[model samples]
Target: MFTGLSAFPLTPMNEQGVNEHEFIRLVECLAEAEVDSIGVLGSTGNYAYLSSEERARVAKLSVENAGNVPVVVGIGALRTRDVLANAENAQQAGAGGVLLAPVSYQKLTDDEVFSLYETVCRSLSVPLCVYDNPGTTHFHFSDELHGRIAQLPQVASIKIPPVQNDLAAAKARVAGLRALLPSDVTIGISGDPAAATGLLAGCDAWYSVIGGLYPEIALALTRAAQAGDTEQAIARSAALEPLWALYQEYGGSLRVAATIAELTGNVSQPCLPQPLRTLQGEARKRVEAVIDMLSLS
Candidate 1:
């Protein structure tokens, strides 16, 4: 379930809360594309903003609509007790795995973070993926800390941040992590811009944002790299430079993704939760221009 491409779709919202019809459509789209797994309630799904009830519903909706695709639900929360609840909900919703980030308001010590995983792992029936998304969670996982956490019984994968762009450096970094993790535990790379290099460098999987929207192209890159077709994978990634630039210019993938979703009519305009607005005016124009130039759906 951990290997290959795991597409993380946006949890489109309306004033009434999660737009179940649209969210299901997104999940069905991914399943039809035959992605390795569907990641629901992820950072891209705005897990942090949704209430536990909303999250439980989203998890259920994703798994129910995803056909045979394995569903990995994000169970991150500010409190360990809440994380446990989310984990239980995901398990009940039949998630194949759960992704947990050490979400925190105050700075957490290594021991505190370790304890959080320990407590959650004890209660989990499903496998857990360590979500080391420092950009959102604000808690960084040192390599040493990662080694320690990977030893936990249910730890199946570690979703690391982007690798260095240089292939050799990326390979070395992935090699170092490989030594720390058990052979059964895989390393999945996030950061869409660097995915091709990371995959070519030996990371086992791509925990992809772009894959959620453009599964065919992302899968082409994944398959090319997995087949050791370096030139093809690099060229494919290079073709999407304009899209990656939009992510950088917009501060992150969330706004740009929501913008694309809106532009494509996959979801209603103003799809994001309160206070998290989509790109406006010129920023929106640039995103549209890039989408057209790239012929992105």
Candidate 2:
């Protein structure tokens, strides 16, 4: 089972709206950090904005740079065929596994959700991780549903994001689900700020986006927690909190991605499409100051 941190690098867009070399360089840094794994074209990867070709190219480059580290491609589309195609391309590009979200369009039932996962598990030769992002999906999974998904032979893990309400309840649900699932099946948490807490709650992995900028700190925190040093983990997490604060300040994923790109020197010009506003004034200045303090770029 794969454990620890899995850094999801942001997919960059050049002036020509192309994913540039700078983006690939960022993934290489994560490889240098020796993170447990890499998730390509994930929500943080801006999977929704890129063209199919662009998505495949990013996945290929991510895997190549990742070397021995496992690369998990995010395959979430409105249609089943599209999701399958993406998965096929990731496999062809040498991805270690595929992380799937429920098809983003239309209201889907629990049966449809399981069926989508079952089909993907049956179609792909690689491992599968279910992304239970209820914030986006608007449909939460029950412990019984989670256990059922974990029982599938090809399904290896589940990615649960930290919800705003009743975190203790959510953590308890994961603990109970973990007990019900096979010993090999891992339960991962996706929120970067609550990573150490999630691991303490029995999550096997922390799927992170901010780690792209401070992979060493992120990895250190996870190691500290796994080694039973809560003080060490808490101290490292305290130092790492500013980066997460920047993400929250932006109030959007694009700015979060831009902050990461700027911190890593991945690209000097990071732009967001329609709907996602740009950072400016006090907000941009504050983010820049934090970036400088970390000396990440």
- The candidate 2 region of ten consecutive residues with least summed lDDT is 269-278
Model 1 residue 94 lDDT score: 94
* Residue-level lDDT tens digits of model 2 in 164-255: 32447656867778887889989888877777777766788888877765688788888987887867876776776777787676663457
Error of 1 at 140 (Å): 1.3
Error of 1 at 139 (Å): 1.2
Query: TM-score for each prediction?
Result: 0.99, 0.91
lDDT of 1 by residue, 1-297 (tens): 998999999999966799989999999999999999999888999999999999999999998999999999999999998999999999999999999999999999999999999999999988999999999878889998999999999999999999989999999999998998889999999999999999999999999998889899899999999999999999999999999999898898999999999998999888999889999999999998998999986
Best by TM-score: 1
Index of the highest-lDDT prediction: 1
